[model samples]
Target: MADIAAASHMSLATVDRVLNRRKGVSSRTIERVLKAAVELGYLNPEAHEQLAAPRPPNIVFLLPMGTNPYLRLLGEKVRAVADAHSRDQPPIRCFFIDSFDAKALAAGIRQHARWADGIAFMGIDHPLVREAIEEVGASGTRLVTIVSDLPHPARETYIGLDNQVAGRTAAYLLGRFCGGRKGSVALVAGSRTYRAHSERETGFLSLIEELQPGIEVIGMREGHDDRNENYQHALALIEQHPDLVGIYNVGGSSDGIARALTQKQKSGDIVFIGHGLTHDTRRLLIEGTMDAVINSDPDQVISATLAHFNGVAQASTRNHHLQHLKIELILRENIPLQYV
Candidate 1:
């Protein structure tokens, strides 16, 4: 029981209160804790004593495959929760789908729909994908979305950073650090098809236009969150525009941007501000290869997602609850240590 509480990262008081049905518990927070406990089978032994009774509800967590490091981190957290609960009897079964491939992602989601008491998936403001997500939620199972979310036809509250705010933050840091120099800025991002990166780029360019009108935002490359592809683009951009003052990598491509920057002749002269503090980003922050990194904790995002999921389940919140986006600005002085 304590293990479940610890892995869920909730306080012992809260966990105890929920398990005991204590008075004065907020329905939303209670639901979150109960969901975690039920998913983990914390009451499995008691249930085994009564074979005729119905078992606990099973929730299915559908996540993207770990094609990127960020997704891997996400999977690790989910696995930790699942592992803690299934000590004897298997707990909630987790399903994985790759968001990069449209067909596979949709198919995996459809296949897992039948067994799920709850659903959590990512969908942006697209037409067909959005429609599919909406239809699935109508199946009477709780739905949760991670990363980018469809604001209008929402599917449970999204639990991730505000991509646009992150973009604007990146621009602000880069512009200020560049000392108002009128040089080009490279915008490396994930796939343009990914709504999160697209929104970030939009916000970043808007800020660049308003704040540093003189700084030419060049080298807009869809690095596809591929480090090598990012490096290739960065190298090409530098070759084309030797006077690049800063690089604004608004997604996973930041590592590649840092690598490219390291190879340049005037490496220290240029500045870099990117999003997310992956392992590579953390190293770069310490080494001063990157100027600033706008990041969010994946574990925190997962916790928030669970809280929002419970909130919606209890009718206390909407699917697209405007939870405050966390933006951590990392520098050499205040680099965050990665916790596994």
Candidate 2:
């Protein structure tokens, strides 16, 4: 590795940073080393002594786990990471909940605070849920929320898109895509009980009202945070307003929309915009049935959450970065070609 670094004319310390993906290395520098490391079989320091000797910090990730295909991938990424970090330190103990039940999720988080060095959780809003989070904080747990955020009693750091801005940005794209075809816009969202979806809907309608006054905003349906619900609701929506010109998927169910749109006679009748960078969304975007998907870098969420526990808590990212989160407007023209 040192020989490779020498050949590349970079310091060994710089090579180490590139190998481990430690921040502070410029993207250009990282690109150079990564290009080299890909060709090299091993990273420097034969054994992961640094990570193991200094025991990686204990971080409890409190998020949803279900049949979610994208989350399944996220879980694999988090777990694929070396458990013992560098073969010397105590292994990072990661725990997860298998359902979205608020009570169960709250309980799972509470269970971790006893011995955990810190807790990083996805924020959920609701009086009881918010109170439960506060209770965890009182117990001295470091909390964090991703994608959708928790308000009032905010967490130590939020690690996802500024949802409201994301929603507004989606609206902007939808308006641009609409090309002034004055028509009603339907919103498909998860439970209004969830703050993130609620805020996105709010931002969406606000932008539509301000920018496209002629465009009608239809009242939304509660997706209930369920895939089947999104599927059923989306079909019902098309049936309700056969002339509906645009769709804003605030929270759940991209597959539901594509499944609904499939077999239809219309090719690209109405515009669609939603969140997340899931494989299902990718396929739909490529097929041209779904229109635009706004992205929030889920990997960044992982890194940000890890950062707080790793000892450098970022207060606020740039507004554009927060709004975008490496967010891409995925359309048929520029959707990712492969999941790999």
Candidate 3:
């Protein structure tokens, strides 16, 4: 290995990684190492040729079946990645599963475990799902949690924003937007089964209590990330709390809440803050209905996931250095330009 490393003008560890087919070494580096090995008589010429061109690993993306605009955008981005790499890489499959059902989600994980070299999914915090992830990971498949996370040690890494910080940021923004108003605030969540949503809710409430003691949190309701359900919940909150001055959505389906606010003629009256940047959220921000949108770029999420599978050194850390994306706060005046 030392001789090959010297010949290749690379480090001994890098040469070892390439020779052992381990991750964190790029294809170009592998080729260079193999070429050096062939020249040094450490590897056969024919074997070197074969090792220089390795087959791309198959990756499966499991997204939730939902109407959430952000999730829908993620699905589209995943599909686009699959389509773009169809010719050079192994077939990439993206499946929409009932993430709310633990059994169904576990089954989906197990079903794809047979052929996937790596599996990325929006995780649900369920025992069955964790078992499936552990089982697949035990079989030498890489497991990644995206968007939402499972608090299990079996997964390789989580690729998303820090939900707790996102929630706290929302709370701070809502409190500030309300201008220290003495009124009640309401919270709407997608579902507590998703660790991301639950964490966001926890963070939001904790910060609200500490930072704005005067503002009362009326209560929290589950919207299931459904537009109609969120709409109904928002409407009910409006009726119940005539002194409502703010609302924090810990999950997606911001459009439904916007609709309810508009119907109640409380569009800009209530300080509304939610997660995810989508077409509807963009419109809401532009129209002055939403005070702020907390978001993580879908492109960054996808790139980080792919980088892990591709054996990029930066993404190989288990501490989620590369996978933990920055949180973006989008307001009406500072909304980013939309691309085609």
Candidate that scores best on lDDT: 3
Error of 2 at 308 (Å): 1.6
Query: Cα lDDT for residue 33, model 3?
Result: 94
lDDT of each: 0.68, 0.67, 0.85
RMSD of 3: 7.9
Supply the TM-score for candidate 2: 0.75
Off by over 4 Å in 1: 1-57, 86-96, 152-154, 314-320, 338-340
Per-residue alpha-carbon lDDT of candidate 2 for residues 1-340, written as tens digits (9 for 90 to 100): 7965976679999988666644345667765665565457454443333322333445666656654455556666666553536633323455667444677667877787665556665555656667777787665555666666665443665666667787898899888888888888888876665667888887887798788777888888876546777778778877888778888888755777666767454437878787766887887787787788887656676766675566643334312122225556667677665444
Q: Residue 233 deviation, candidate 2, in Å?
A: 0.7
Lowest summed lDDT window (length 10), candidate 3: 313-322
Candidate scoring better on TM-score of 2 and 3? 3
Tell me how candidate 1 scores on lDDT. 0.68
How well is each residue in 224-339 modelled by candidate 3, as lDDT tens digits?
89999999999999999999999998989999999999999999899999989999999999899999999999999988888787773222355533267999999888888862
- Candidate 2: 10-residue stretch with minimal lDDT: 315-324
